[model samples]
Target: MTFTFKKAVRSESKLRLALEGISGSGKTYSALRLAKGLGGKIAVVDTERGSASLYSGLPGIPEFDVLELTDSFSPEVYVDAIHAAEEAGYNVIILDSITPEWSGKNGCLELADLYSKGNSLAGWKKVTPLHRKFLDTIVNSKCHIIATMRSKAAVSMVDGKVKKVQDKTEQRDGTEFEFTVVLSIDRDSHNAVASKDRTGLFKDPEVLTEETGKKLLSWLSGAATISPEIQAEAEKAAQLGVESIKNFMASLKESKPDQHALFSDAEKKRLYVVARKADINATQQGK
Candidate 1:
């Protein structure tokens, strides 16, 4: 199931990629990697600390740009920054964090949910109709967008003693509710997991590109989604893995100077068969 969003390549295609997890989820770095791969000027809307600076230094963030907001900042500043990007025709845009603006006003998503005027239903409630007017004007613009949310690791105690399950949780700081896609840092493993992706791509209940899943499935067991194109890619990676498999390769040896050997034809064939099986498994499971 190699996935390609068949949507024709619009000059300013709107993409809403999200990352959510508790602290240490490595979401920031991953966001930058995605930005680099996408290859265009991406806006880094910073509401948390100024971590975008750290991203700027990385070789991975070639097209990085920053938009900083402080405690005293207003929503218009954010709107303007996005407006500027869209008007100039940036290929990618990132709202590193959109919660702070509402959080400062003590009116985040939950309040938006509680107040009938706030949700998608009523369209971001306008007290004077000015803010609503402003928000509408922005979303209507064309910009490939990615937004990040802050998250906390939470556990529910079923009996008030026995722990039930770990959850990527969001609690309102006040009247403000945070958006989902809260990427966190890992304690030891340091791998980013999409603790939750409301749209169900690039997160747990992991949505792997078919090729990526095919290549990586040997290490996983949970549910995964793969497109046909990615499935073929998985097969290729598997076949390539064989060259490293049959070599009996040891860590670079002081005894042997520099030496290497190619995979035996037999080894390549064996790995290719194994990869094909894995691809079949993914396709059957998807059905």
Candidate 2:
């Protein structure tokens, strides 16, 4: 076999965003808001009961589907959920609280413990493959993946004075490294900081919202340039006729694929619905 080399090209890839925060840190609400910004059909792999659905009716929050994984947090279960979401045509899959799958009840750690009995070194062998599979699924999935992790305060006795310490996620050590962006949220303030970002999208702490999600998308798509005139016309056409809107989207994709990322799947869906209504009304009038 001969070794080959080629010029590096930009990879228009999906995102893997990890949000870590302690309980009451608004990680669930924030993640849903971000997912709304991601566009297309959004699905949540819910583990904390039905908590993901509670914010459904909030303003700016789009309606989304959910799959509850309350039975077990096994690694295989996570793999299954990723496949199911991909098969269902969801553009974004929010794995809310991946923490449980790693360390919570019935998770990988438990399985390792059961198999190893007392041998610490042997325990990892049982769990490593399971973790690798799940991680591979998250990294290689076609859809955008956002995972939330539960965090706990890291406390240590310093000079005999107990003080609140830095937050640590319940996931395996170095789990944050797998994600394209790692956001650490303050439990009380609800502020988020991009502790790690491959895209250089979020440099400082900010409140995570739909807009934040949009900004990240823009960066991911190379911040494509679209003239003001074309954008205005596209918006007008989208409002007036369904066929025109479809044509407009098609033209954008062909001419400026980068700018096409500007429109979210949710926005496109809403416009399509309006266009369909107009067509129906027009047909009735003609008849």
Candidate 3:
């Protein structure tokens, strides 16, 4: 294979941010505030039972759309919702408490347990791909993403005294590396400290607000360029035949009518073509 290189340059990009905190640390509100600052049509995938909705019409909080996930927390379910939101033209999407996707009922953990059937290692082997796909969906999404993760209080014994400390985030380990920014929020003051920041905007711990998002947006604005992954997907979709795309759309309309209804005609055609390409690739690999 031949190799080629080009001068590296920064381009305007979507945000992949994660907020980590215990309950009452104001992660949901903080996400909304940051989204407000980012300045776009926002959508929230609420896994916390309408918690994000409670903040609607509050001071400094802009109006936004919400899609509540009551029971199902599967990765595919989340992926479909994200696609729907992206098709609907949301500029930013808040995954309010991604914790449930990792640990809640019908989540990855439970799915692994069911798949493993008494073999833990074997179970994760089957489930890891699903989890990775979830991560990839987040990473490659065209819209900016703000995901909230729940953390527990860590306690340590210091000189025979139990001291409470901030716990690690509650999702899969190493999940922080996926985001451009990861903020750890204080429970009492709700001030956020950057555990990880690729942007270099937050140097000191401060209260998260709309300004924080605006700063991020300002930093993110640059010369626009298509990402290699998106470009590749588009190229693959272009290679697919119109008849195949139509067949996939017809199948989707029959099998997933509700999800099918979420897409516009153009989006439906594009999505079906891309999905068909993915299916063909998977079949080829299997063969």
In angstroms, the error of model 2 at 114 is 0.8
- Candidate 2, residue 267: how far the Cα is off, in Å: 26
Per-residue lDDT of model 1, residues 1-287, tens digit only: 79767654223324445555555555566666655544456677776679777767655455567767665334566677778878776766776665454554433443345455435556345322534443453456565555655665666556566432335434323212222233344433444455444424333322112222222221122222343553354345664444333232332122221121122223336566775666677678789
TM-score of each: 0.52, 0.73, 0.73
lDDT of 3 by residue, 169-219 (tens): 789998888999999998767889989988766667777877577667656
lDDT measured at residue 125 in model 2 versus the true structure, 0 to 100: 92
| Model 2 regions lying over 4 Å from their true place | 2-11, 154-166, 224-287
CA shift of 236, model 3, Å: 56
Report the number of clashing residue pairs per model.
28, 0, 0
Q: What overall lDDT goes with each candidate model?
A: 0.48, 0.82, 0.81
In terms of lDDT, which candidate is strongest?
2
Query: What's the lDDT for residue 48 in model 2?
Result: 94
Give the total clashing residue pairs for model 1: 28
